[model samples]
Target: MFLLVLLQVLQPAGAQFCPDLCVCSGGAAELRSVQCGGAGMSALPVNVPPDTVKLRLERTLISRVPRAAFYNLSELRFLWLSYNSVTSVHPSSFVNLKALRELRLDGNLLTSFPWEGLRDMPRLQTLGLNNNRLSSLPAHAALFLPNITYLDLSSNRLTILPAELLDLWFPLPELQKGPVRRKILGLHDNPWLCDCQLSMLTSLSSSLGSPVVLMDQLLMCSRSMAPSGMLLTRAELSRCTRPSVQPAATRVVSPLGSNVILRCDASGYPTPTLTWIRTSAYTDCCQQNLLQNSEQPPRILESFMQGSPRVGVRWSIITLNGLSYQDAGEYRCQARNMAGTSEAPIKLKVMGVTRLSRFPKRKPKKTPFKSSPKFRKPNQTLPEKESPFIFPPLKNKIQKV
Candidate 1:
């Protein structure tokens, strides 16, 4: 009985039996580390202690990670699953790893990752995804990993990246102030396309004191307009010109109380910003005044803009709802970039009255008693009153009597 009591005192509180072919080490109060590798394991160990802070599973035969695989390990901080045959991971696999700081999944057969699951790991800073077969990444991946400092994406099959990701990676010079933290980004050993978009990467990499640190490997383009397998640093990208706009319709005719959609497309080397502006109103009195004031800025209309990064093209669209006579105007589609600016004009014409104003006019009714001879007056005519339905004739139109 005394020996049994001593054995009980040596065990940890709420401790469970460790898995076979694995090793666990810590004091009697808690388990701090677990290492499982090359033990012919086909799946993750289920009996890992809840208090484990570090877990390493290397050279295993695990194929995929299921949801809630580590739900019981809340204190886990450092996880290394290198050199496994992992092909995919569930979106919710890391939902419970709130305290996870560094995650390494290098040397796998993954073609894609569950980027949405990264939101659960707010403290994650170092991510190792090199030596995989990823061809593309989501445009908003940077939004999920806001605190990422070290990102390894070398030896992949990436060709083009979205403009949204580049904008976040290198913000405007005015917005970058104060002491910038050192960030390491590994983007070598990929087949990058040589285009106006790729030129941005070369220019940004040459900056003297940039906070970002790209690996020392030289970048080369696999496909380009000039020649294949050309060095990115020596490519002639200055031949790319400013944006040009192509309007769908130069003149549009619509009736009042109707809807109309205007569309225009722009193409350039460095993508350009598309804007819709109202250059002149339809009012006759304001038409001359608007044309005389050349310095007056045109009114900008709310529009939706979308881009295709692969082809370096963008489209702008605007919908006019409940068209009124006041909506008739000349609209200009403007595309601007570092190279230069271009514009295309579209004239809109509105006709016919609105449905709400098309009701028949009613005349005042005459009562028999009021019009009787007994109430008649001699040679005194009732004051003439004009009807409210009378409207002025349109400018430059003849009125029939």
Candidate 2:
């Protein structure tokens, strides 16, 4: 017993301190890293050495990440949680990893982004969320990734872009035309609906200066309409505008003090501006008054996205409230743009009874939208005009056309 006690007292203190599942090699409290990769672990290993900087759990059977999973590892800088079956992450799972630089969550079963999970990672540089089942991202989610330099959102299902997405993500100063501006914004392998609304995103793509790219080659759109499988780089407004009224002119009937809506659809680059004008020989109570001062004016202009190709059937709708005798007239829905303008008229017949006209409505606007060259290797060279985009013409990470 005396000899045993003496031997223990002389032994190294690190032996009993190391985690049972992990293989510790360094001296006491000085372990550099831990690798539980392919260890078939279902959860994070706790009681890690205090000085440990790298922790790898790749190819593990871990299914979920519990709250404050890494709270004790304040010094952890590199975390590898990829190639696992992780599906859910508690909002506080990564809150304590303030020093984490790179987080790999790819090849998981995640259906949605846990934006709240990254609340405290100020030094996080790269975020790999690729090859997941994410269908959408919170509109304000990009606001939380200012320090992130590389982001991967490839392979998922998304049809529309969030409103004011570019404005909220990259500030105006960072978007100024120049060399070396934007970072790697991967948006490949998703079904994008390229329509007038998509013009907003394409316009943003143009403003994103040199040295930065959003995976131009992978920028493609698909739909059952005229254009399908078209590259976004060739989807310029000027190249895709054909203005015309959606439906043939008709007559609208409504009662006094009732509500009514007149709609017109047009197609073009920059989405043609809509103007509602009261026209017709209205010598009756309805006069030129509509051309002058009027309170409770039109509130909004509604537009629709049909998921067709470029500018596939844009709409302009106007609402009229508290209708009176003075409101009865021939109203014109004019669609205008730099290319030109087209007007479609509707006659209003007010009566006490609600009725539908036996007349038929017009057919859809006929126009085909699609284009761009075949795919090529990144190392291959190509012509100037055949190239998709040439903006920030001077230079970028990928050479400017």
Candidate 3:
């Protein structure tokens, strides 16, 4: 077998010395390329060949590349910077690479990118963003990706494809007015939540829209586990739904003056806001005083934003303190969002206790006369009805000294 080699010519100026710990080679005459992978350099090397066509810098320590890093390389085409510590990128980093075609940015920590920066490159075709930590796409991501024929977003933390993306990519004239192109989209290995809105991707047809070739076998549900592991194409998203209050278990019988924590977990699109409301009409835990007319109806005992992605996950916690006889009633946790409102009831039963002590007891004193009420001793145990001691319950989680 005969091997073909591209001729390499070295110009006399600064082209003779290659960048430290990097291998640079290509034709200096018409087509040039630079191979600088695994250099262990922390910054973009200075003085790259001006006529470099292809540049590879995989597995390097380069953390970031500012706007003017590759400003001079007008003939640059293919660029690879995968497996690096690149956390950010300036909008104008590729402003001068007009002849660029393919761009690779896999295995990085880019949560978001500048979308308007793509207006500079009119000839862009392919883009790879796999193996990254992207949770959500920008709303206007479609405007910047109109000309893309191939896109890869696999192995990321994406749950739902935004409605904006679905309407813009398909060829339907009513949804979006643009020249529709048959594109190959890679979205495997993502924590894709099969929301009902995602049905648009799998339901595209050639008559009214361009044929979308979604890899359904590889598109398994991530958050809500299934037994058969159905594909996205066959999974009826409308049928594939669950209530906001999953499992729907909330009821506690905490003792009087005892602190109790009521859990309210919700799951829905656009994340739900959790709030606790006392069902009784008379009072609530947040009521400052019984005599105040403008008490504002207790202002919801507690409220918190459930920490989770806007998909099938969990909600927040609510701690009710110093349970009293009045607090023994129905408490409902309401979760409301743009989708709708759902509530879970917590029936609390608070039992009264006159006294309870964990302190060391004292010995009884000798009663000389039996006429008196039997000379009560400190060591004597008080029955449920006879004890006169009543202590305030704890306010917070920690015990007060």
Candidate 4:
């Protein structure tokens, strides 16, 4: 009875299982390891031993993965489905593979990702989603697989990190508990925006005490360099990805109006946080009350003339209203997040509309009044203004008058 039960437990699904034509090996392996990769496989075989430990199906022509394909594989651990033409992964696929650990899905044409499918593998650690067309990593990605230490998400079309993804472990509260640390976050090949949206990534790199590795180097800017050129190196991406810092030199541009924006721009790791502090708080205290849009304004101002906040490639805008000379002073914009803090000083110079007196007015010189040609009468007889001319033409012409 014990020998019969052991044979039943070791048996694969279905009776007299024959290796499919898609797999190169003819199921001749007496053990569990199988090498079925690159045999023109369009779909997973219908019958295979549940105890198969290593399954290699890479570089095949498989397009769609069927649901319930990998169920009851209690012993399957390492699965390589990379370098295929897979477009979509059904959510029900890989639902029961509780022992799956390392899965590689790189170099595929996958446009949409099945987050639900991968999350089913609770014990998953290393996930490779590199070289795809994923634009955004959905929120709570880290939460689904908390044990994931090696994540490779390089070479995607992502313009910016998701807004809620302030940190790698932002979604998982336990991971954000300050003492926790991740081994690696492979975010290189993706087109990352070098703006404040990526401040968290930049700031975390400094705290990590090393440069965040992209594919070939560190970070590749989405907009900084040529598209087809070599990947950005660690040094080139250092300043670009670091959180913004305050500039030592301050510049003040005072414009005309009751409302003015004290513009602050600087560079550092973890993009600088902006906070406007009126140095002459008591003197221009009334003006502070007049400041409009006190509530958090949209991140960027649309008006071309208005100031914009400086992030990786651009600037951030802050508005101030009811300007006075007292409003002019050192106003600090403090930028802070989990990584670090950066304070940029904006020396406010309130430039109101130039009063006529304030502007040097030309003095109205007393012009000698000249009689108008229309109003003047011709002189009829100029009698003895001087002695009448005696000789008419002494040297040249005879007097015709």
Candidate 5:
């Protein structure tokens, strides 16, 4: 009895630390790795051994990561939660992962990440966020992930990236130094807008002694007047250009009490801001003279603007509601950027109201119907059709030996 009890105590300490539905591997005294997966897991496993160095929990139904989820796993070096349905993670979910070097959340449903949480993982080097639904990142995201050497952001809905982040990867001449290891940045398969910003990335990538490696895939951008699949390395994007406006129509005619939408699209590097100004000449001499003054500005009309940096395009629309004679004027869409400013004019003319007549509803006349002789009834039985190229049955010829 004493011998059996001693054997049970000496069996394995790592096995006892394993959480339910998880498999652990390590020496007899400590657990180093724990892996938990399958459709049955709906939440993160608790009570992971404090000494565990690696943990993988993938392909589960885990939708959210609660705060301090891994508070005790201080020695963890790698944590992968790929292919999960995780949509959100609390800012403090990675609280105690100080020694962590690699963290992967690929193939998740995350639309936004808590970049502030990176403070907890100070020693992290490799970060994987590929195959997610992220469309944008905060401007200051580069501050927290400064030391990251291997970054994966491919296959996301990213259209534009902050210049600060790009600067981090491709430092200025004065800031560049001999890196301990070559940095790898994966940015392909994104809808990058071909602007001066993207042009800077391409130019940096082509530098003779750059330390960063953009994966071996051509980065493409969406641009007006360009082919559907244009590569970013084109010479057109090599330099910054002034902003230019493309108006849908130069003149608009609308009836009184009706609404009309005037659209203006602008393109340039350093994405431009569009403004709508009501520049119609005023009747009062003082006002007209003031408007003519170069220093004086016209009245700015209320408008809606949307910009897609990924496509290097910004558009603005102003709606003239309840068009009246007083609303007739020339509106100017002024697009301004660091490069230069450009304007496009739209002239609106409102005419007297003309009433439209409503036609009365008419019902169809009922008529007696007869079936065509060529049409067959649903329940009618037809003669059997012969099969084409039918083979005849062979007779069994017995050969007497």
Candidate 6:
């Protein structure tokens, strides 16, 4: 057999150009690449290989990722820029990385999701964006990341999950194949409003032995029987979605100087929860102060929409501070244990004015001091009145002070 040698192009400059973007140690022979994560780079660093397989820029100061940031990096497989101060992931940011497999972008400042930016990575397998400030997932957010198997979405501020999340097939259909099922799901640590709208998540929990596990346990309930709190375990959550066993009505009552009480009167396999929250500015009062557990309340929150269909997450008030307007806002009553949280929202409106009345002055009865009864002189001889003794003119005038 003839001996064969494999020749690889060597670049001496790769060792010298390791700036704050990455730190390369040893010589080029042992160094595969450089990673400059959290380097505070304003833009992509200089001297990075176009074909580098792994690039980590997490927690960096890079605000604007240019379109050509990774131009011609056909061999690039892994790119991590999570926890950076990045506000936006520009459109076409990752268009050239067709071979990318894993991308980590959790813990960044993304107001709206970048749906289009991720479509170009056809081979991307794992994506992480767990801890961000996303109130709601965009409709069909999973379409862009179809190939993702492992997703991390813990520790975010998500009030209402998209209805599409119920249609799990649409988001990730590819994971259904192969002998080893693609383990694809991550939804803990989100402030999931435990309501009828989220009944689907409760239902799904039953089909799977557990709430599909993907991320860590950092979920907080945005609306529940209580103020902000964490959600319960998966098994209990499944029982919460079962159909009612009794037909009931929600009753709300206000108590004297204590927290309000929200009650639910729905019949289901397990009793549901009652929770509340402040209305969002985008919605009118009719939509605001809504029942967190019910899609709609049996009555309009303010009776403005009286004819509207009745849903059943009831509210009762236990007013604190004599019930003043300042105490008015939104409150959530959440009921959750091993089962996931179920909640309802009640808006407290101090009906009529809430002012204290001055105490009434008590009338004084005319209590006549009755004259002592005049009785005839006792049978015994009345003491004889002594003859009036006449005193003389008197002593000398008292001396003046």
Q: Could you estimate the TM-score for every candidate? A: 0.61, 0.52, 0.53, 0.50, 0.56, 0.50
Best candidate, TM-score = 1
Local lDDT at 266 for model 5? 93
Candidate 3, superposed: residue stretches over 4 Å from native:
1-17, 174-179, 205-211, 215-217, 224-230, 238-401
Candidate 2 vs 5: which has more lDDT: 5
What lDDT does model 3 reach? 0.66
Ten-residue segment with the worst summed lDDT in candidate 4? 298-307
- Candidate 2 segments whose C-alpha is farther than 4 A from its true place: 1-31, 173-181, 196-208, 224-228, 234-401
Task: Mark the regions of model 4 whose C-alpha exceeds 4 Å error after superposition.
Answer: 1-18, 21-31, 170-179, 199-203, 206-216, 224-401
lDDT of each: 0.75, 0.64, 0.66, 0.58, 0.77, 0.52
Worst 10 residues of 3 by lDDT: 1-10
Q: What is the lDDT of candidate 2?
A: 0.64
Q: List the residue pairs that clash in candidate 2.
A: 211-396, 211-397
| Backbone collision tally, model 5 | 1
Tens-place lDDT digits, model 4, residues 1-401: 35534565667654433345533332335536655656457777655555567677777788888887777466778887888888888878887888888888888888877777776788888888898888877765645656676778888777666544454544335445555544466787677655544544645555644424323335666574334333443323344443464433476645545676545454554444445554432224334544443343323323222232454423455566666654555656655533444455656665544345566789756444443454334752323332334322321234432
Ranking according to lDDT, highest score first: 5, 1, 3, 2, 4, 6
Best by lDDT: 5
lDDT of 2 by residue, 151-231 (tens): 787776666555434444444564555533356767778787765445545555557363335655456677622267877
Candidate 3 lDDT tens digits, 143-170:
8887878788888888877655665566
